[model samples]
Target: MSLFVTYVLVLGRSLESSRGLLELLTPALELEVDDSPLSLSLHAAAIQLWCLVNSRSFSSSDKILTEAYSRLRTAIQDPLQRGCESTVLAALLLQRYERFSAVWNQHEQCHVHRNGALALLRQQKLDGINSKHRGYLISQLFHSEVNICISKKISFQASEITWLRDQDLSILPSNPSTALDIIGASIASHQHKFTLLSAEEFITASKPDLSQWYQDLQDTEDQLNNWPSTVPRHWLPQTLQSGKHFDQSIITYAGYSDIYPNIQIASIWNLWRTYCLLLLQIKLALLGLFPNLDEPTGTTQDPRIPAFKVKSVQLAQVLVDSICQSVSFHLGNYIEPTSLSELMIPTILCTSYHDMDPSHISYTLYQKSSLFMSRDDHRRHVIVQGPWHMMGTLSHVLSILADSESHIPVHALREGQMNWVRTQFLRVLRLLRIDLEDLSATNQDHCQANPGDLHALNTVNSEIIAKRLMAALAG
Candidate 1:
């Protein structure tokens, strides 16, 4: 896939819906196979597989997918023959396929493709492609790596990209996707470097000066606190209560959820809130990690820990409520599986940040976070772009949620995540009178959404879900 291919998705065609995407590709297929047709085929196959998985019926032994993969693999063997940009696109498509298809199988080549893409991008950057076009792929590769770092809980520099290091933060406008990515970068960096602030590491021979670690953490925290000031006031999210007019209901699970003109803006705001909560979680974990330390005297109880706890609870309450409030909007009439996937990452993480209290006492961050939503948020709908495994809204919401649950439950989620999933997520189900020990996320192996007949399935399910969801909210 050349830069033109990516432009087809981002700038050229209007992908207001999946049908628009299909229309975009119809013409793409007729073009001369000059710029890596295998790459386009790989992407097309991934989309077809996504449609199949969503359709709920399929039988080809994945031969089409397999052939596309083979062609992409052979093409990449001498990447320069077709160009590394095209290979990176194919690799990214493969990365995406692995994510949503995790329920069927975990492809080991997932990282092989990602690393290959990264290596090529790094080589290009080091050699200086000098073309602004390559910058888009670099930005995407940068975003992919950022997501991997945060999702995998690795340090910020864990996958250092030199371009990212040298990129000036101020040039990116304050509140859009770029700024949000920068925010994630900062938090991921802090999460990785947070080790210095740990009391357990204070005495370790390899540890840096303990005070400097605290200073850096404080600086990051301050930066985060001040980030919102940079955003234009009109672009910030507006709070809306349920009894108020909305696409779904008059009230929210926690009494209110925030609303935005569109999903991207919503995600941008939520990302900030979620990242802040995550930073607090990191601090809280450390405080609890060293609770019994009498030897550390003044060292163990940082002055900020108490404040962090209070702020965490307040943020959790507001965040969860607002997310639940907005869940229905995100679930509304229709959405693309890919859009739903992107929107729900922050939604799921917001709940996870507020997670559970092992002592089993304080409050549930996922509270009434929608017994309806918890079920859908994890559905593994396949999209070969990023890690969005979850159910789709209407059927769209249900589809998106189903995919989220599918990963590994099919890829976006990993093991031990269910440690808390078993408790909090199940609690939501129990309230709905459903018997479940954990999120269906733990049931990827049992999922059977094979795609086909989406029109029929969604037509039936959307009406059913819309009615029941409204009743549930009203009750």
Candidate 2:
């Protein structure tokens, strides 16, 4: 009894402090308690508590996690004990990563543990774990299952995703804004991987059949332009402009500002927008990779879900909506005609410095844009490019997620009621691009003369506007 308590406390503390120890203990606990039902329950609970620590690096910690995970993966003589262990491990695995379907598939040969795990989670009447903890466990499980089903070509049940979004897992206080931030980060991490594939797709498309891929991309861009003025959800604005020259007004904090009033900043939408773009990029890349690739893309490997049906069309729409809504724009008007160093990187846009809006647009744009941009000068140039460019590089991941057929029915990514999301991204991009181009030309023409002249003109305009406003106020 004392040994168990010591193990619990020391292991708990170790898990909390060093992920390496947690990793070692995970499998160790599973092995030691495999025969005892009570021990299994306690170990599972401990695993959950351990997961809620500060160090949660998924890829880096996979070694230890997998080592521990192996112990709970066997076909045990006791079905009930095996099932309970499976449930706990499944929840842990899902919580750590969304690609559990693939992992599960790789180990499906051991059906006893898998079945046991599924049964354990499916049973709501299990004792020991409280409702709140159950919800958290289920939430993690759902997220993993849904995303895994999404990444693999599998069928999903509608109840899953709905359960996740609708389920009240409020064990802890979660600020709406902070929750959104976490969601954005999670989506972005996945989207970043997809973007990498998207870039590769671009390269592949550009290599030989540039016309086809480029044309397709152009068509998609055009479709994005036709979106309506209103955004999908939680998006600040649909359109933005970046002048040819660098900016200066907001540069004091926003990003770069070589010239004044050139950069137009606005929020795009939600995390979904990022996901959608990644999906599109992946689809395009896959199509580009094997133009005649069958619907299943035999080369794409088995579906993530055991034998679930996939939904490509709906998934595509979801991906598109996600990317379009999440995007924000930074427009440049009369930026500095000087060297690039004169321009500022968009670092001041973080949550810490979003209040530093020169145009007084509000906090929406400030927060959305600042999520990805950092003040680190060393990486300023690298981060300045738009989300599309970044997401484009990770096309594969987005493609995997966007490809509904790849998704297996997990609790999170279910085929919910279809909701229409209208957009005009392509049209707005084209319009803004043209407008900025003209402005750039005008700025260049103006630049033929002394830059002092342009500064003088701006000063005079400022004085006139200020005096007019002052007079009106005085009246």
Candidate 3:
């Protein structure tokens, strides 16, 4: 959309000079400055390593990382001290560090760090660490995990689902993340455990408890319908219909999108719709929307298939609009005057581009169909921004000239609207060229090494990337 591309340019132009980003800290790391936080030397070092990664001091990136890993090895050796709140926070920051090293951290480094944080949190719960900080930590971790799974289309294993269901449900309903958190357990099960892997497997699996399975399905639908009402007025989004003057090339695949008070809130709204879209497909499959898996190739068609597509587009149109609108806030041309807000730009914008992951669906439901030349071809013909389009030439070559197609970025430029800002944006993208190329190369290795499964597949949307995306936006 012209909306997001413009804001991205505005922010990209300012990234290099935002040396003070670590001082502000992200929302999750806004720890009380008292002695209760990061007392241990390992925790202190982890925070320092996090700072090094974000300060754009790539010269020290490798050396300090080596030291961080050595200290982490030392800390992990003592199982008795592992469950402390300080330890969890340290692991979380190290997770941030792994995310920043786009060149080499690959899927393995960050995923390993994430598992470390999760394990530490699990241990804390077992040790009766019921403090407020622990609760905050767990919720943030769950948010990350859900995003990871949705972004990659990973099916949660049975053990992970069990862990999700057992989490604290006492979080206040008024909290923004709580709405998603409350039903996340159901989502985990719906996403993987009870999903339709195949018609025969599903039928066989549910036969033993058909009634309970349908009951769970009904309860999930109820939760989704009821979840929005529980939100406080300020947290709720304003619904707006598209107008005659609206740019069809941009947004409103449906007739409307949402207006949120901030990018964070908008991100949450988009995350919800993404989940809705994911579940819609599964629900449709379960209800026989796709062809039956057991029948001979091309031999069986569910009568509901045609109706399912019409309905899917109808429902998905608005969800698509909402997701784009959410990304729009992150690309703010006039949302706020402060650079601090820029530090929060996240993967809601970065991961919005796609092929809809073949592991999930045959058709690209989540991505706008406009990205392709025609419904029949599915070949990308338009020029869209790729992941971290803030990174240079390679992204443009890959996302625009090659696959991941759409003409949104081209349109953003053709209007000559933000011409002045475009130069600065490209400058920053070019600056990070190596990092982005390395990330792409490493991800390719991950795909080849673990054929058909990608572990560290999501964007590393580190503080540095957020800072770069926001830093150059002039008031």
Candidate 4:
């Protein structure tokens, strides 16, 4: 077997054994007598895709994906077969494959798989099944659905999954398992509220009742405030001390290698904060509040708006800075692909916020370096290779860079890195089949736009593209 396949089998086997579901989901040994053919097929296809991605064998990956999807379609056509645990497991594996291998425009298929998983859960009453493996699968599917909803600017199907709930901080002291359950559920709840607020109807409809919205925001903020006290100390944000050789180089400054035992959980905490900041931005936008360094002289200004903007910016900066500090630890240690993928969503959220400033000088330098350095040279020097999905995040980063038309000096970037970042952005857009002509017009409009106008424009553009891609996939 390929090394990538070997790693997947080993990791899957470990998880299966730990969950005490080895008999149900055997990942290590060859196809067992009791294993469903559909499950075995999915297991094989997932292994093949992993190897193909690592090896950059796109042709083979496409072939394997096609065959696996065919089998999946046939299996899911039968209601009885679709409702089985094996089919759910197969669906999860297929979703993983799509996430890693799907081309940019085809990403909506990930959501299709998520919806399928949810349907199976409902049909089989899997939520009532008290298996650890079932809980794991549910959590994974829940997170995936939330991510799709956020990324695509789609409305959360709240009515479809009423079982999700907010995290209960009171229970964390006595039960870690319940705490995890709450955390997963809470993420779904927050994402749902976020989607509701962001929907087109909410934005364009006649002015909403600000009172209820404000109360919801307060409730979320309170929950966030209460969250840190419940978690273990290591999962709380840590202050990174400057190393003795701090001034050695840009790379050295960016590389703050203080690894924590619970860095993964710490990353999740930071992600939650980032989500809060995003919601704050949406709330502020609804109230026509925006950061304006220039003093507003007109009577239209709300005196408190400036303070709110400052506070919002500060909170966003803190959350982003915490995430960047932890990046060094992730770089120093080995993180599985799944964990790394989880980390990318927060990074994307942080980068997408147009006004938040980078907290560390090194972070700014690293971004500058990414723009200036040759791709080959940067790859040779960088310690961690972020997953493929990170390309989408980088595309958003590139948009931010490009959108800083008059505010930032273009000439300041090193010629090579500027060319490189632009090239990569174009490459991503091309893969997504986004029109270059439209993007140029959008960029021109943004250049002439005010901060608030630009923010709205970006939001609309994102939603338009997301809707288009999703519709295309559905058709």
Q: Which candidate leads the pack in TM-score?
A: 1
Which lDDT tens digits does candidate 3 get at residues 192-280?
Answer: 64334545765566432544554576677777767677654545555444443222322332344344333334445555664565555
> Model 4, 1-475: lDDT tens per residue?
3333332333212221121122234542234232443444455555554444343344554655566567667777876666556666666666555554454334455456657777777666664433345655555555554545454445455535545434222312232323333443444454455446546665554323444555555666666566667754433343344333222121111344332322223334544554554455454554442223123334255566566656655565554344445443333221222222322233221111011134644334434431223322222112222222223333333332343221222343333333433433333333223443435566635533532221233332432343333332320
- The TM-scores, one per candidate, come to 0.57, 0.30, 0.52, 0.56
Off by over 4 Å in 3: 1-59, 71-83, 102-110, 126-131, 148-157, 160-168, 171-174, 193-196, 203-215, 239-258, 289-309, 333-475
The per-prediction CA RMSD against the true structure, in angstroms, equals 13.6, 21.1, 15.1, 12.0
Between the candidate structures 2 and 4, which one is better when assessed by TM-score? 4
Instruction: Please give the range of 10 consecutive residues that has the lowest summed lDDT in model 2.
Output: 417-426
lDDT winner between candidates 1 and 3:
1
**Candidate 4 — worst ten consecutive residues by lDDT sum?**
347-356
Give the true-structure RMSD of model 2: 21.1
Across residues 1-475, which tens digit of lDDT does each residue of candidate 1 receive?
3222332243212222111122234343443363353445555554544344244332442665666667776776663634544455566555555543432221222455556666766666534433223544455566666665654446657575645577653422222455556667777776665444445545463323444554565676787787777754434455544443332322124444454433434445555665665665555554444442322434545555565456555654554444444443333322223332443453222221112342422223223222112322322111221111111112122222232211112112223222222222222222122222222433322222421112222122232332233222210
Q: Please identify which of the two predictions, 2 or 3, would achieve the higher TM-score against the true structure.
A: 3
Question: Candidate 2, residues 1-475: lDDT per residue as tens digits?
Answer: 2232333323212211121111233444545444443334334444432332222222443444454445445423335544443445443433323222222122222233323444565553334332223433443344334333333323334323333344444631232222332243234333333345437555455433544543444444443433323222322332222232222332121232211111111212322343344444444454444444333324453334312123444455545433332232221222222223323534323111222344544334533442323323212222232322222212222333334443312223423211111112112222112112222445535544543233322111222222221121110
lDDT of 2: 0.32
lDDT, residue 153, model 1: 46
lDDT score at residue 190, model 2, on the 0-100 scale: 34
Best by lDDT: 4
